[model samples]
Target: SPQDLTVSLIPVSGLKAGKNAPSAKIAKLVVNSTTLKEFGVRGISNNVVDSTGTAWRVAGKNTGKEIGVGLSSDSLRRSDSTEKWNGVNWMTFNSNDTLDIVLTGPAQNVTADTYPITLDVVGYQP
Candidate 1:
């Protein structure tokens, strides 16, 4: 059975993620975005974007360099494949980071629908 728990807004949407995510102690972010209506397209392009239509770009905190590119749900799932990605050699996100996922492209079947992006916090570090 699914548990019903209320998700508090991360200081309301449309705001910038200046430093970190609002959630307490959550260091890693496992963002799972799913469309309410099926796009039917197997390999459509998707990314995390902001309210201003700008794709949210992530980078290393210390180095201030752009991080690895986004990965698909399937690609992110395959340990063998995901580990091969060269851009980002780590799996972690800073606290209070505001991120949103979006799917686009692949010609047709890319239906215009709402995609609910769910965040799964990992390694609670207070």
Candidate 2:
């Protein structure tokens, strides 16, 4: 079901952006599975990387000094422990029919101001 999924990145609440932040453009990204498949096999793998050899894309123009992206999770809550983490877990990507991704930057040399970024995850499966 990986083909049915999409991933994106956003700033964390405490890791917000400063004023006039340099617009961060999504750059060369590689997406692929580390599952039983070899490093560069075809079809047998999931939507690891688009044939174009890129991972993510910027959706719209700069709206402010900040931005956001969405992510998805399969097992909403792992470990089955009653406790919850105070922060989001830095996801380890796997092609186990799950969703995983990374988000980098506030654009280079963004203003020194602090801004809050939040990731709204949806379409999670288990």
Candidate 3:
């Protein structure tokens, strides 16, 4: 695979803290097009939580598949007091985080010039 895939900081908002710092988990991931085909997995570090500690390939339309990279925790708590947003405070949590992805396989069956892949993040609170 070539160095064609890219990772960006997708703004995170509407975050809430659980009773404690909820552990991170990989909810789901979806890829868009063939444009993300040349990327390959390297290594992911930081505060990422790998529930299974194993990454799986998401079955796609053709030979192209979305890879499940995992998820991380971005919940922030008030330092001074127990402040809860009663539909009034619009406090959001933004982290200097990134979605690490790599391309492994080639385009399968689709014939579209460029495919647009989308990665999704889901959080679990307990």
Query: Per-candidate TM vs. native?
Result: 0.23, 0.21, 0.22
- What's the residue-level lDDT of 37 in candidate 3? 24
Best by TM-score: 1
Alpha-carbon deviation at 114 in model 3, angstroms: 36
For candidate 1, the lDDT comes to 0.27
**Backbone Cα, N, C clashes tallied per candidate:** 8, 8, 12
Global lDDT of model 3: 0.28
**1-126: candidate 3 lDDT, tens digit per residue:** 432323453333332222212232323222222333211111232222332222234434554533333233222231111212332222222222233232223322322222233332221111
Candidate 1 residue lDDT tens string, 1-126: 232222232223442323433221212223322211111011111433422122233433444543212223332333221111233222332233333333222212222223232332322221
Q: Which segments of candidate 2 are over 4 A away from where they belong?
A: 1-107
Range of the 10 consecutive residues with the lowest summed lDDT in candidate 2: 37-46
Question: Which residue pairs collide in model 1, if any?
Answer: 20-95, 20-96, 20-97, 21-95, 21-96, 21-97, 22-96, 47-102
Off by over 4 Å in 3: 1-3, 20-38, 46-126
Worst 10 residues of 1 by lDDT: 35-44
Quality of model 2 by C-alpha lDDT:
0.28
TM-score of 2: 0.21
Candidate 1 lDDT score at position 92: 34
